[model samples]
Target: MKKMLIVFLIFAFSLSAKEVPSSGEMMFDLIPIRPLGLAALAIGSGFFVLSIPIGLLSADPRQTLEQSARRLVIYPLHFTFQRPVGEFYGYMEEIEYVSD
Candidate 1:
């Protein structure tokens, strides 16, 4: 138990001493943001599946499906995986361009 505690303390100190900018942000992103993003992706995918029939039935199925897919599914997927660690704004711009 004592040895384990010492190892844990060392690991914690190492994390704090790293040169990475916004380590706190990275930790926050890793611990909560990523998981929440994944959850959003899952929930959005489910919603997209449910919206499929409506999209197909719309006056313009292609447009409806494309918009819905981008909003509900692709956005979360990109935010979750493609965004750089500790950097938040770039992915939104990318997605905006893609949507346009």
Candidate 2:
């Protein structure tokens, strides 16, 4: 009975074992980005940044206000107030403008 039980357990463990497929058999393929691809990405990012101000200027006042509010919330503690030229001390300032 002990030998039979050990054989059964071995068979059960073997049945539960899973076989992984080779890398070539993977469903998704990863492609490396070339230098040209990176350059294109940089150019696209620059264009996106340049377009924001143009869009803001062309957009309505309400949209601009909403955008400004969103920016303030995203960068809550960004700006600091420094003495311009002849002041003795520097101070940290909350640079956000909240609207009603």
Candidate 3:
């Protein structure tokens, strides 16, 4: 009975293993994000006003604000539109690669 149970458990585990996607499927999943990026940029631009006070409190007000704006608006849009369609390779690459 113990041997039969072990065999059954192994068989169940094997059945749960899924095959990997084909090259085409993988490629399809990596399409460029031009539209999405543009939208995020617009949304982030609207939030710039919210960062003003935080920026003012920092030692370098203008630069702090600029950095925040770049992170919130510029970088996301740039990476989304310009990056390799299927790979993480630029500024945000480390965060993305590690997360995925």
Predicted model with the maximum TM-score: 1
The clash numbers for all candidates, in the given order, read 0, 0, 0
lDDT for 91 (candidate 2)? 28
Q: Candidate 1: which stretches are off by over 4 Å? A: 1-20, 96-100
Task: Give, for candidate 2, the lowest lDDT window spanning 10 residues.
Answer: 79-88
Candidate 3 C-alpha error for residue 74, in Å: 1.9
RMSD value for candidate 2: 20.2
Question: On lDDT, who's better, 2 or 3?
Answer: 3
Ranking by lDDT: 1, 3, 2
State the weakest 10-residue window (summed lDDT) of model 1.
90-99
Name the lDDT of candidate 2: 0.44
Question: Each model's TM-score, in the order given?
Answer: 0.72, 0.25, 0.47
Candidate 3 lDDT tens digits, 12-90: 8885554566666546535444556677788887787688887899999978987787788767776666554545445
Residue 22 Cα positional deviation in candidate 3, in Å, after optimal superposition: 8.3
Task: Name the candidate, 2 or 3, with the larger TM-score value.
Answer: 3
For 1-100, candidate 2 gives per-residue lDDT tens digits of: 9999999999888855545544543322112223333454455556556656765776485676466444432232222122122222222243345757
Winner on lDDT (1 vs 2) = 1
Candidate 2's C-alpha runs over 4 A off are 1-33, 60-100
